[model samples]
Target chain A: MSFIQRAVKVPPNSVSLEEARHRVFDFFRAACRSIPTIMEIYNLDDVVAPSHLRSVVASEIRKNSSVTNPKVIDMLLFKAMEELNNITEHAKQRHHIIGQYVVGHQGLVQDLGTKDQGASGFLKDFYKSNYF
Target chain B: MALRAALLRHVRIPAQTLNPALTLTGGKWGPPSLRWMSSHDDHLTKSEVTERVLSVVKSFPKVDPSTVTSDVHFQKDLGLDSLDNVEIVMALEEEFKLEIPDKEADKIDSTNLAIEYIYNHPMAG
Candidate 1:
């Protein structure tokens, strides 16, 4: 089991409060990186222009205005983290991590919707494999 | 579509109109009286500075402001942990258009305190 996961229960049943906190934070950190990874993969060259990206990013940041379901956030966070953990490539890791952070975060990810195949299909594939 | 929607949503919240409480005074940002209050409000009047804050802060569907009060600690009383604080700060800043330096932001314990700060702020006057 991962060093971090060990703090939680074995067999992945119940996570300690402390472990849960770390898991939430670590999950956010890793998922924040996932955005650019998908961006680079899809090669939307200048797809989301910097100026446009700024607005897009702002909406993403504003996603967590309400303290919506923390459970959903945690689930997504863990799912995103798992995706980043599985990647073997070198250059893509950075992008993957950043994307993960943006989408995984509370407010930032809210503005961003999962319309793009890059985020949904590919990213989902990453999450499903790792979460299991 | 999602990106467009998110951008539009943020664009809708005019920062200057933020702090629904302070709007009555027709000013933005906060006043200086805020530095005097305690860390949290334990008791006060119906128009208690903090209670007024709760009235409006809770209006937003996303944030349940009912839990707020003078004694309502920012993190504990209100469900606002950290990011919520950041968002509230942003909303407040946008409403008042005043830079609540991180130092002062930390001092804002209740809605009343926030109102006091806005009331006496140089910008408010």
Candidate 2:
């Protein structure tokens, strides 16, 4: 587990967007490197491959792609790093990992009943992942 | 060159006389004729490396398998984003069991580059 112990030091703020973009890629690589240990720790091999988890991490980063501010990107990256640390440390349970990442946002609640089939798109979108 | 040959003759005469004596003494040391091998000899061939590299690039979910070629760019030809590019490089690393440095990894944007990098890598087994 000593390998999992990363330097959690706070790097100085990026002076420009180019620097911030580099930091994001560095963080993304770090997260991808840890997927093997994360899979072993959470017993995710049965449901997900490393590539799928890699894409999931990328999608999570893409979710905040609209934010152009370097400071905001830094903050989001810090939060993402903290989440990755908690996950690699086994501070989370198997179902937590499954529900949050593997099963995806829509996999959590699927209304199989025909009664909701006639529901408006807005309601369905709201039920899916909060935002329309 | 003549002086060097004369020196070699003198050294070889002693070594020839000592070889049987050393072997008769049951010494652990062996003659200089023995050869040692290292993992360097277990290198992957260029064709095999290229084939595996292409397979890895084609397997990426967002890549159209048919559109993939040795010279196709991940972003321009395959239409993948930067993240997908990184993901593909990571997949190649996993396949070859080689940890490419970040600087070199960022440079591998196409199948040809990936194959060339992995093929030239001494420890890419």
Compare the candidates by TM-score and give the number of the best one. 2
Expressed as tens digits, the lDDT of each residue in B87-115 for candidate 2 is 89999988998888999999999898999
Docking class of 2: medium
lDDT over C-alpha atoms for residue A44 of model 2: 90
The best candidate by lDDT is 2
lDDT (C-alpha) at residue A92 in model 1? 47
Per-candidate TM-scores read: 0.32, 0.79
Instruction: Tell me the lDDT of model 1 at A13.
Output: 25
- Output the TM-score of candidate 1: 0.32
Report the lDDT tens digits of candidate 2 across residue range A1-132: 552456366778889998898889999999988999999998999999898898889999999889889999988888788889889888899988888889888886687789888888888788786422
Per-residue CA lDDT of model 1 for B3-97, tens digit only, reads: 99999988895556457666544445656455445533443334543444555466534556556555555667665665345445444554454
Mind giving the per-residue lDDT tens digits that candidate 1 earns over A1-132? 463463332234224544454454433323333434555664534535222232333344346434345565455455545444454233345444345433333323332555644575656555544312
Each model's lDDT comes to 0.49, 0.85
> How many clashes in each structure?
45, 0
